[model samples]
Target: MGSDYSKDNCVHKPPMDERNLQGLKDYLINYNLPDGHEGYINILLYGMVAAGKTSIINTFFSALDPDGRTVTCVPTGMDPNSLTLELKTYKLAKLKFWDTAGWNAMLKSHVKPKELLRMILEGRIPIGTNLQNFKPTFPEEYPVIPGNAIHGVAFIFDMTTMDNISGNIMLRFQELQTIAAQICGHRVVIGTKFEKLGINEKNHAWIYEYKPLQQKFEQLSASTGLNKQCMFVVSNQWNGEHITMIKRILALYALENMIRNIDRSLKMTA
Candidate 1:
């Protein structure tokens, strides 16, 4: 086996092809915290407006249960100024997800977004603590529990529109990583709309070899100040009642990687 046993020439189907999809999906369904205390693996997701966080999340449900319909973990098409309330928590398979309100740019936090993110990791901000209604009287202080607090953080970006991300936002994401490493040592960079690359949509296995996706990964890794290894991309077939099997596996693979990254915070190597 010479470095993945495929050498560097394997393109059409590399190590991360359909072979690992079902395994990854099964792993998540059966996954549990290594500590064995049974706690939700809280992971925080952040990004700009229309970054495809909700779409990517819903797609995960479709991946997990291909025979079933997708679930709205976080409300999509949000109107922050409107009276609609956010879900208290997007809990599934003991993985709890938290996302910011869709009204304003995450960079537009009442305080710097990193500070707010810090508040989340430390477990100070409770569920439903929307930035639009921030008040000193609310959100009683608390400590980061193994199951309750945000143990990992992931930044979402639109794969189709990554070129348009501003330098300032990139810098902000970099700054946030400082807090992530210190708090939980878990951080993921996700690119949504992977199918938008110039490659054929059905050729999902060629993702790593495809020139356009490879370039986008390089660009995002460089811009976000994260390692290319920490980056993952997925196609968003969120609206489809029935997704192709390859796409389902790809989505589950992305979800599994994100969870495994969170597990690092809980001291799991794999």
Candidate 2:
């Protein structure tokens, strides 16, 4: 945790040709990170399968990379005897994203929960038994408590699917909240894949695009006492204007929270 913010004190004044000297003079501009800053934000992304979690990460990375830095999302099947496990990360200015596996039950069976429960009652799971191996063995999935420095978690959900099922919708919400609370209480619910929904509201934002689902989620959140933790709804694949709006919303919700954490760190040190 070191601040990349610093004033350049480069002493080697290169003797450039006339053309290069003019170019250098024009390119000189002041840019720096604030004093006593360790410039990095750790964001943990959680969501269900195909909920556009990876796409949100990709969008943020692409937005930060003016040079079009590429990020990859490698798919893994839910095979029981798979050997290789791959983790993906998308890095940007002062931000590093850890996109964990979405919740799909196919690979989770590898854990043998009944045996683990027996071990817990017998006090064996904690007694010199490897807990990592006992984790819900899903493709691209890791145990929830891997990192302690997770500042915030963007809990992405597909609004369209959530809306399709009228009854038992709150079940997923409860599950999501439980998982988030188990990991850390910093959870923000985001609705992704808004392009599939029609848009006729203000500025074509996904917030307006999925009004029915949004209201359902709000009602569920209120009943569950989790409305306060809810943040923004985003559709990063929207057209130019909508894309800008979504980016701004995500930044305000996700990125700004990280910034506030950094500020808190500075204040505590002071």
Residue 156 CA displacement from its true place in model 2, Å: 0.6
**TM-scores for all candidates?**
0.81, 0.55
Best of the candidates, lDDT = 1
Worst 10 residues of 2 by lDDT: 4-13
Give a tens-digit lDDT track for model 2, residues 54-162. 6676555433333333333333234342212223445555555665445443135345333332222222222233433456444134333322244456767776785
Model 1, position 37, has a per-residue lDDT of 45
The regions of model 1 sitting more than 4 angstroms off are 1-19, 66-68, 77-88, 102-109, 136-146, 268-270
Candidate 1 on 195-270: residue-level lDDT in tens?
Answer: 6665565556556666666677778777767877777776665445666667777667667777876676567543
Q: List the residue pairs that clash in candidate 1.
A: none
Q: Where in model 2 is the C-alpha error above 4 Å? A: 1-39, 65-85, 112-148, 164-176, 182-185, 200-202, 205-210, 220-224, 239-253, 258-270
| Candidate 1 local Cα displacement, residue 64, angstroms | 0.4
